[model samples]
Target: MTSSLFEPEPGKDKEASSASMPPALKLSLEMGPLVIFFVANFFGQWLIDHVPLFSSFEKPIFPATALFMIAIISSLATSWILARRVLVMPLVSGVFVLIFGSLTLWLQDATFVKIKPTITSVLFALILFGGLLFKKSLLGYVFDSAFQLDAEGWRKLTFRWAFFFLFLALVNEIIWRNFSDDFWTNFHVLASTIFTFIFLATQMPMIMRHSLEQPPSDKNEDHAD
Candidate 1:
């Protein structure tokens, strides 16, 4: 989506109105699908028993996966409709959901679905690190709409996120390999979300430290002259 959503109008004081994701809207777009997936998985049997709508599926995970896939696609579409473009992160995740989710259903193997997060995380990590190799801070594109940071800040933030994504990938691999399906599912929805938010919170001091000083706009400079 265009960073304009976060940018202030020309005449406004930039410091008074920094670009940012509206918390409620951000949560809805980011967490809404995951919440749906979790609820479907946790209460699959109950849903099948209580609601005739879900009775057609013999297995619980199948229906849950189907609903999860649908929710994710819908969420992405909604974001696009609202923002007039797709955010890179969600767009990438949505593509993986379509690919692996289809495989999971077609092959009737939860393995595909289970590995989706790992694959997504690893891919993102690689992309971030790869950009750094070429002297690009691609993560800035992802967050620029919501934050104003100097070049150094973007570089540091990108490096930290690259490592973070790698860490998440490793954790997902370990969990899904050793844990039960239910446990892994819960981890994906609950634990991962919590950990991600905590990590983001921990980075606040760095973000503030690296925030770019608001420069005088051309109009303001002209007025001053």
Candidate 2:
């Protein structure tokens, strides 16, 4: 099963089972808003010029941000309507989008909107590290439904994810501050998504090694008894 932005902690919400959508649909729901945001930014000027519908805004970025904000909200609403519950990460990301997106529109400064991803990444990194300090494997809570790993596996996986988030935060800061707006927006959608999928793929071995499957011997013994 594909993991959601907010994974239900194990044993916490029975209702999540019925609420969950198919994995492919869930991934689409998660990625759709970002894809829209990227397209809006990439083609904002053309949209403004060619589409009378988008001409009301003074600048391309303004309308793009507005559309992006609406997309985020719409995505979240759809998730809730379909799943009956929100995942943690998407919910956090959606809140930041609404906040910074509103600020960007009101202040007419894209800087606020650009910093939202950095803020979210850093916040996720901090939460993971803080959980580690307390000897809690919070990442397990996020992935427990997908992978039943041993304690050490969970710890290692959590550590890896914590560092990965920190790296993403730093990368976002660098790209947005040093690059053109168009470049940054494109990178935000593409690079981050690619890196995340790659990271998850690289963890397959560790996940298999720590999986909670019973041995053949154990199954045979149980059957004999």
Candidate 3:
């Protein structure tokens, strides 16, 4: 009935304590919603059809919405426990999930749920790009605590990610609007994961190239300074 979650793993274990935390931990935490969504969808029918607390969630729509809410809360709790604060992007996504998921269930239309990822992606792109427009590296706020990238490297990485998320948004909109639920679901999980992993892999060269060539403590910043 309960599960003990392992503490959030650090992204760069090599310099584990040097960095605030790991990007991988943030990535894994972000997956919390998707994992909950998929699991809830998969077993929804069985529960609503048999169980009582979920009896009110007899409909697929309600169960899906309920799961979104539960996932958001759980994600916030996890982040609070690990980082002692709620992350911005996850909080943003959670708000959208609660809002749109509620609309989908209330309207008995799945379109709202289907568009959740698209909306999330687009919003992320906007936020990232907007920061760049003002010559601000907002990614620093999210990733600074994780891996330390040089200023130029952080700028380039943020811009690339902004565009990448926009592209993903377009792809999600196209697929969900045109394809069957089974097709969308399968591609959402499998294809998306593969694409993301490959994208992260492709960034290795940039990461290595921009890494703090030496420890960033006093003597190092002073030498560079």
Q: All candidates' lDDT scores?
A: 0.76, 0.78, 0.71
**TM-score of every candidate relative to the true structure:** 0.81, 0.83, 0.78
lDDT of 1: 0.76
Say which candidate scores most in TM-score: 2
lDDT of 3 at 121: 90
- Over 1-225, each residue of candidate 1 has an lDDT whose tens digit, in order, gives 234432233223344333233536655887888888888988888877887866766556666888888988887777656654455677788889889989987877889999999999999999999988998888875666467777767878899999999999999999999998889889999999988989989887767667665443522332211
User: What is the overall TM-score of model 3 with all chains considered together?
Assistant: 0.78
Q: Put the candidates in TM-score order, highest first.
A: 2, 1, 3
Mark the regions of model 1 whose C-alpha exceeds 4 Å error after superposition: 1-23, 50-58, 213-225
lDDT of 2 by residue, 108-222 (tens): 7889988999999899888889988998878865576567666767877898999999999999999999998888888899999999989999987766666667453433343
Residue-wise C-alpha lDDT for candidate 3, range 58-81, written one tens digit per residue: 455457567767888788788777
Model 1 TM-score, 2 decimals: 0.81
Candidate 2 residue pairs in backbone clash: 6-87, 6-88
Off by over 4 Å in 2: 1-7, 11-19, 50-59, 214-225
Error of 3 at 136 (Å): 1.4
Worst 10-residue stretch by lDDT in candidate 3? Answer: 1-10
